[model samples]
Target: MRRRFWLLLPLLSLAGALQAQAPLDLPQQAASAQPAEAADYQVLDFDWQDKSRQREVPVRLYWPAQAASAAVPLVVFSHGLGGSRQGYSYLGRYWASQGYASLHVQHVGSDRRIWTGNVFSLIGRLQDAAKESEALDRVRDMRFALDRLLAAEQGAHIDRQRIVAAGHSYGATTSLLLAGARPPDAPAGLQDERIRAAIIISAPPFYGQGAPEPILAPVRVPTLHVTATEDVINVPGYHSEAGDRLSVFEATGGQRKRLAVFTGGSHSIFTDRAGTGGVTLNPQVKAATRELTLAFLSSVFEGREEGLQSWHQRWKPLLARWQ
Candidate 1:
């Protein structure tokens, strides 16, 4: 018995050593985490046809008037339910102004047409969006957008390795799927391996009261989730509260995940479009979104830690919401 105990002591010591050597996964939090005039950027437009999906995806491309270099980062922006590719033009222009090629992709079935004439139909539309087929189609639209851009002549200007998948509300859900977020019963191949980072705003849990662990299980990529204290969507058979958005922030597995919560703001703040259930527009929120989004992207794509650190130091006091 004494001989066996002594032999096990060495194994226990080795186990302790291994445990001590385990990596610490501390999240890179920021108070808030930009584009400027004279940023040397411009916009170009195109309409793409996804023959397989039978969808006409109209895209607005925002890029530097002159290529900054042989390659620049790409950011694809998807808008919320009842939003258009052009809905988030502010983000596209801002990113392009900051030297990225921002591609705004329009998801047909769930675009502005959903709210065109009847606000009463929103619940039905939301239910439809929750269906597996509709969700997968949205992801396919993004993947196909990547394919078209990477295959285009202008594709030469893009740094394929630094692509960002970003979206607002329902669009945020789409971006999550692309960034490896697994909803309750989603299809395979929804995640695009080319996505390096993601920016999701007002994202829904899509877990339906289930444990968020598995809902966000696939979200291993760097993600920045932005939402507001007033970011709540309650309708018949559907509800999206702040907790749902933050679940992504908490459940996503990575040291690079971040979250920014805005006080006295609405979920519509994430979308540039106003009149979204009376979301009073606030420029400060917009500014914070622009600055922090750029900083987050810089941190991941350019390895510019200083910008993130600077954001943490400066905006931590300015922005009321940080976690």
Candidate 2:
């Protein structure tokens, strides 16, 4: 169930919008703050219809401190092929603390449990021979989540100008597709215009026979593609090729498009504090990954140019081989 970016064409999908003032549709838009000036963020779980998985999807959300009554920047996080809402918790917490609204979505059939036992059942869904609909479901899921969130009373509270889509591996592919990166044979309807930025981590070359195109190619928004040269899953497969594809975006007009490679890290290196078995949890990979991811997010989200510099300074020695 850990989906590859190359196999994306077969699984694109959709979400329905909720009406305003519906608490079930929106939940509490903001986080609760303690009286003592403690860390404040709203973490809530909500359900959305996932046509690809044919079930109601649950999402975990985090929001920044109540600094403004208007809409704030938003960061929607997606998990890897076999991941859950909890997979990208690190980004959610970090962004929420920095004044952005973030959400982690759970993909039912493609989650860890399914991958553990019924992976074939999920894979069977993608048996369209051509894999034309590979990521169709995930695309729908992202769109519906956006619709539901924006339709919520608090949805209006989100700063549409700064909406960002981010994820790891398959999730990163989802982020890219939502941001409008199309494989040569991709369906036209799958694009979501609301996404203003993208942060893709360890995405693969799953777009079938399409020539290598940067995930940021069609996106008019800023984008950050983060990968690890040591990534056993992607480096030899997708990361190297994607840079060529995404370069097209610069011509299309977006600001600050960048690709950051972590020298000593692996595919799952961008994970939260508690990383998956293959990436963050490993003793040798933990600290370096944590520092790099935190710094990358800080720079990309907070506009702290130093975030990039700090990452290079710390990892340049390890990544010297990449250079």
Q: Of the candidates shown, which would achieve the greatest lDDT relative to the real structure?
A: 1
What is the per-residue lDDT of model 1 for residues 1-323, given as tens digits with 9 covering 90 to 100?
21111011110000100011121222223111123456567677788999987888888888866664668889988877667777776678777777788999888766766656567876566555445566677789899988998899879888888999998877887898899876545557888999999998777665543677776776888999888666666553445556666776788766788888765455665566433322222444565677789999988877887877776666553344675
lDDT of 2 by residue, 1-323 (tens): 22333564211211011111211111121111111224777778887776655766778888666735656888787777556787656557656666678878776656555445465565454333113354666677777788888887668678777778887767877787787776655668776787867776666554434344444446666666665444444321222333432333333235656665544444554554222323222322334333454565566657787876865665554342321
Q: Which stretches of candidate 1 lie over 4 Å from their true place?
A: 1-39, 117-126, 274-281
Best by TM-score: 1
Model 1 / residue 110 / CA error / Å: 0.3
Assess each prediction's global lDDT (C-alpha) against the native.
0.68, 0.57
TM-score of structure candidate 1: 0.82
Worst-scoring 10-residue span by lDDT in model 2: 14-23
Q: Candidate 1 — what's its lDDT?
A: 0.68
Tell me the RMSD of model 2 versus the true structure: 11.0
